[model samples]
Target: MSNRPYIVGNWKMHGTRAMLAEARAIDRAAERLIKVEVALAPPSTLIHACRKEANLIGIGAQDCHPADGGAHTGDISAAMLKDAGAGFTIVGHSERRADHGETNVLVKQKAEAAIEAGMGAIVCVGETEEDRDAGKAEATVGEQLKASLPEGEAAAANVTVAYEPVWAIGTGRTPTPEDIAIMHRNIRAQLVEVYGEAGQEIRILYGGSVKPENAVELLSADDVGGALVGGASLTAESFLGIIIAAAGDDAE
Candidate 1:
């Protein structure tokens, strides 16, 4: 929303109390790297700890239950995440979609829930390698984005779109810049179609196997507002490298 590149780290199923030190260091570096917007989604157990350590960087949740309160066991809701100091939550990530069989409708509900709970939601939508090979990548992602995005004007303000190809995630395989640019352009068109001009303000983040080496080139891709880093974000050293890359782009 601030026009600063939104670089987020998804620490998925990682981090303990000991990892707070790295979070602190990342936060400190983020304070200095004012040109870029940095955030981290640590495990739920460490959300509060990371929040306490983060002064400039944002602390967020990897996922959240759509319900505010319920009998559901081992599920944290958007309200609970906000209470724990998470300013935002990632919904519809590839892992959740594949591992938990999450549907587009359910993902949309989750995004709406997060917005209702006064938190931001990063809605993820991407296709698999098979979809790409079949020439259905854009079509697949377009449908997912349309179904997964929350409704209303508030969505334009509270929602961020993350594109993470299923096959590329954790595989050290990445699409070419031309491919990423094309996908992002399609995504942007979809957003504009849904949210109108306000959609232009929503940041579209590129994810999956994002690291220091590829940060600059990836961020330079058309409509790539930032990145949703995975393993590269576990340590301050690697994560900061990506953040610095975003900052460098912002400077230009």
Candidate 2:
């Protein structure tokens, strides 16, 4: 429905300069990848260096401040990231939403900030295991989506929605195909409500415990445009496999 499905690798706090070897490898391996829009968010320290590498993949930051100019010490605004050649940014990642106490208001601000800086924002929303076990998964995720997502009127087309269940993220756990379907459907429904006709254009990605081995199947699911990969995305080969799988049907 959108221009192209995008697959994003969120390196989180896991990369160092040595990881550049992997980034380069991924770029080289992805030489033939055209059906999917591939990008990665490496550690902030490596953003500039990653940008200077091969040109196949998109480069983005983990996060940014809401304001262009700010008195907040240690805060990097969207303008700075844009100047550094970032084409995307991550907002409301589960860790930030939970650990750092980031609120939906804050996440919304950061998304707006990304638009201001000339970049796309990957906004994340999910539910904890407790919520899932209680059959409250949809309810929890719905609330988060409502607060975390900007109405189509509020945010531009540069927004990407990621459905990452906190229960499954990095815990070596994953949702069943049925569960994934329901959550994504709910997310899409909410987007339609907020964005109206424009909601069909939002790229909805499934994240959490995504690996090369399981990638293709995940990408093929209904409404699953791509993945917001974690652990498996650290390496170029592994990450590339996922991309290759996402582009499986398009193979010619």
Candidate 3:
């Protein structure tokens, strides 16, 4: 929490037991970098395995169901994720929003459920390429953020926001640092308005094909507390590079 850069890897639907080696390697590297707080949200199937392999780094789930239980088949609930050793869950990811047709209201419910189940919620909000092109990026993100977050101190304490433009995700394209900073500032303002002082401390991560090459500068942007990395985070080497970038400012 404490302003220490929170670098999280969203493995999405990829990874299996074979990838555990890479996760272990990432955990070993993370142990050496005390300044950065690293975590991985692997496929739900690997959450417990990853936790068992590495105690130093955090382990999370990519997504969770809003309901605690029922005949929701194929869907895992926040409580189930927690029981599986997931300390956090990423909600409202663009992929989930688009593929599953998840609405902001549903995202908000999932976030609240995560907190209720004793897990942190990394709520994602973003504008599609069309929205960005239309100069409604900030407006789109603002609306999503407002609708997707839960109220109260505990919710604020357990929530982190991520801005991953729909177009940029998995496309290797990213906004300039200035553009990132502007969007982050806008999101930060909204958080403050909603959560007051607590909002200022909510970590806002930038996720969009984040890679080692640009990790340093991107992580250095104003109000950019961390990153929600994609492909680059699949391996220990590349992911460690970004972790090292986060450690720079706090390196002794």
lDDT of 3 by residue, 1-252 (tens): 477899999998889899999899999888778889999999999999999998999999999999989999799999999999999999999999999899999999999999999999999999999998999999999999989997655898999999998899999899989999999999999999998898888999999989989998898889999999999999999998889888995543
For 73-191, candidate 2 gives per-residue lDDT tens digits of: 98888889988878889999999988889999899889988887778888999999899889999999899888877544437488889999998899878887777888899889988
lDDT of 1 by residue, 1-252 (tens): 577899999999988899999999998877778899999999999999888888789999999999989899999999999999999999999999999999999999999999999999999999999999999999999999988999965888999999999998999999988999999999889888998898888899999899999999999988899999999999999999999989994433
In order, candidate lDDTs are 0.92, 0.85, 0.92
**Deviation (Å) of 183 in candidate 2:** 0.9
Question: How badly does each model clash, as a count of residue pairs?
Answer: 0, 0, 0
| Cα shift from native, residue 183, model 3 (Å) | 0.6
lDDT of 1 at 12: 96
Model 3 TM-score, 2 decimals: 0.97
Off by over 4 Å in 3: 249-252
Model 2 segments more than 4 A misplaced: 151-154, 249-252
Worst 10 residues of 3 by lDDT: 243-252
Q: Count clashing residue pairs in model 3.
A: 0
Candidate 1 global TM-score: 0.97
Against the hidden true structure, what lDDT does model 3 obtain? Answer: 0.92
